[model samples]
Target: MSEDVLSQGEIDALLSAISSGEMDADELKEQKQEERKVRDYDFKRALRFSKDQIRGLTRIHENFARLLTSFFAGQLRSFSEVSVASVDQVPYEEFVRSMPQRTVLNIFSVEPLEGRIMYEVNPNIAYAILDRTLGGEGKSSNKVDSLTEIESRIMSRLFEKAFESLEEAWGSLVEIDLTLEEFEVNPQFIQMVSPNETVVIVSLNAQIGETSGMMNICIPHMVLEPIISKLSVHYWMQKEKTKSSPEDAEHLSKSLNNVDVEAKVLLGESGVSIEEFLKLNQEDVIMLNQSIEEPLVMHINNEPKFYVQPGKQKRHMAVQILGETRGEEE
Candidate 1:
C-alpha cells in the first residue's frame, strides 16, 4: 500500500513539474505506468508446484521419514532416524551439479506414472549403512568412494525393501508400485530428464546409529505432472476423509492371522551353582522346582499367556493347553 503512495518530495516535484508546463499530469501518469518494474520469470527454473502443493509434498515425505526410520531400524538392527529437512523446486541440472562425484543414486519408477524418481543417499550415510549391514560399528569412511559389487547388491536389496515404506507413505494420495530401475554412483550418468527441467527435491536428514547424512528424493515436474492436481491441501484433506470399509478390516485381520509368532512351553526350572554346573555330567539329575502335577507355562513371543500339560501326542512331543495364565502370576 505504501508503494502506491507518493512521498512529500515526490508529490511536490510532481506538482511543480505540472505547473511549469514541462509535464502534463495525464502524461506523467502514463510515464509512471511505463516505469513499473516487471518481475523476471525463467522458464527453465519455473515453479511447477505452488506453495500449497509444496506443503503437501512435505507432509507426504514426513510420513515417509517415519516409515523409513522404522524400516531401517529393523533392517539395520540399529538405532536409525529420518526426518524431512527441506523441500525445494529447482532445475534438474542444479540438482545434479549439487551431488557428489560418487554417491548412491537409485533411480526408481512409480508404476501407473510416467517418469522416474531419483532417491539419492549421501556417501557418508550409504557407507554407514553398508558398514552396519556388514557387521561394523556403523562408521563411514572419511573419503567417499564408489560401492563394490557386493556392496551395491546389499544396498539394492536394502533400498528395495525400503520402497515398501515409500509406497505406504504415498498410499493415501495415490496407489503406486515403486520398483528400482537402475543404480548409479555417478550423477553425470543420469540424464533421465532435460537439464532445464524443473524438479522438486525433498531433502531428508537421516541418521543410522551415530552417523548422519542427507538423503534426497528428486521428483521431476514431468513425473508429477499427471497427478499434480492431487498434490493440494484440499485433495489431501479429502483423501483423509475417506473411510475404510468393514471388508478392509476383515482383510487386515486375515493378514495379521497369517503372521508367525514364537510360542514355547516352559519346562520346570532348577538352579545350580557355577562350580556345580561346571562339574555336572550329561546324565546328572537335578531336582525340579515344580512337581510333575503342576502345569507348565506357555509363552507366546516371550509373554506368558497360557498354562499347558506336557505330553506325547502321536509319538510327537506336545503340550495341551490347560487354561490362560493371569499374566506373569501363576
Candidate 2:
C-alpha cells in the first residue's frame, strides 16, 4: 500500500469528538473498561428452557394430564378430570412459593434420568381420594392434618399409582423406572434444586366430582439438560415415526380419516348478559357485529380454520374458500 488516507469528513468528525471529550484519554479508557466489563448474573435465578422445549414439555404433560384424569376417575369411582394447566420455567424458589406449605411433597428419581424430581398432591384432593378409599363419599378439606400410619399407607399406595401413570406417560419418550426416595409434608425442608436454579413447573388442575384442587411437578433444568436434544419437536416427530410400522401407520391414518369432526359455518356472534338473554324470544332477532358481506367463519373441531362465502352448489348449499386463519398454516 502506498499511503493510508483519512477523508476530510472522517477527520472533522474525529476532531469534533476529541474537542467534545468523547475521544479524550479518560473517556477512551472508560469506554474500553465498559466494553470489557462482564454482566452481573444473579446466582439465585436462571432460565434454561427455550420456547420450543417448553412447547414439547407442554405436549408431554398433556398426555400425563389425560392419564391422571382416567386414573383419578377409576380410583375415586367418580367423575374426575385432571388437566395440565400450564408448563413454565421458573426459579426453584418461585416453584416452592406457589406450592402449598403443608402439602405432601414426594421426591423421586428415575433410572437413566439423573437427579431428583418433585411431585406434590394438594391436601384437598388427597383427602378426597383417601375419603373415597375409606368408603366415605368423596370430600375435600383445606385443613392440613398429619398422616397417621393408616393415612401414610393410603398415601404410599397413591404415590405408587401416580408414579406408574407418570412412567407410562414418559414411556413413549424414554423408559425409566421411578423410585420414591423421600416424602415430606413441609416444602421448606425440601431442596429439589438450588434456590437460583431454574426448574420446569408443570401445574395441573384436578377435579374430583364437584371438588377441585391443584397439583404440580417440579423438574430441574439440570436434570433435563442431559437429554435436552430429545425434547425438540423434530426429535419427537422422528421418534413417533420410528415407533410405527408401515401397516400400523396406514391403519392409524385410515382410522383418523374415518373419524368424524365437527364442521360448521358461523353466522356471527353477539354477547348478552343473563338478564337480557333470559328475556329473548325465538322470533326476536339479535344483530351481529359482523357485516353481511364478510366471509363466514368455517369451524372444524370447534376451532376456526377458514373464512368462506355462502353460495349455491347445484342443489346443495356450499361455501367458497376465502382464506385460512393464522392457526391453519402448514
Q: Name the best candidate (by lDDT).
A: 1
Q: Positional deviation of 131 in candidate 2, in angstroms? A: 0.7
Off by over 4 Å in 1: 1-31, 142-146, 241-330
lDDT of each: 0.90, 0.83
Q: What is the clash tally of candidate 1?
A: 0
Error of 2 at 297 (Å): 44
Flag clash pairs in model 1: none
User: How accurate locally is residue 35 in candidate 1, as Cα lDDT from 0 to 100?
Assistant: 82
Rate residue 136 of model 1 by lDDT. Answer: 94
Give me the runs in candidate 2 sitting further than 4 Å from their true place.
1-44, 240-330
lDDT of 2 at 174: 83
Provide the lDDT at 132 for model 2: 78
Question: Lowest summed-lDDT stretch of 10 residues in model 2?
Answer: 37-46
Q: Summarize candidate 1's per-residue lDDT along 112-133 as a digit string, tens digits.
A: 8889999999989988998999
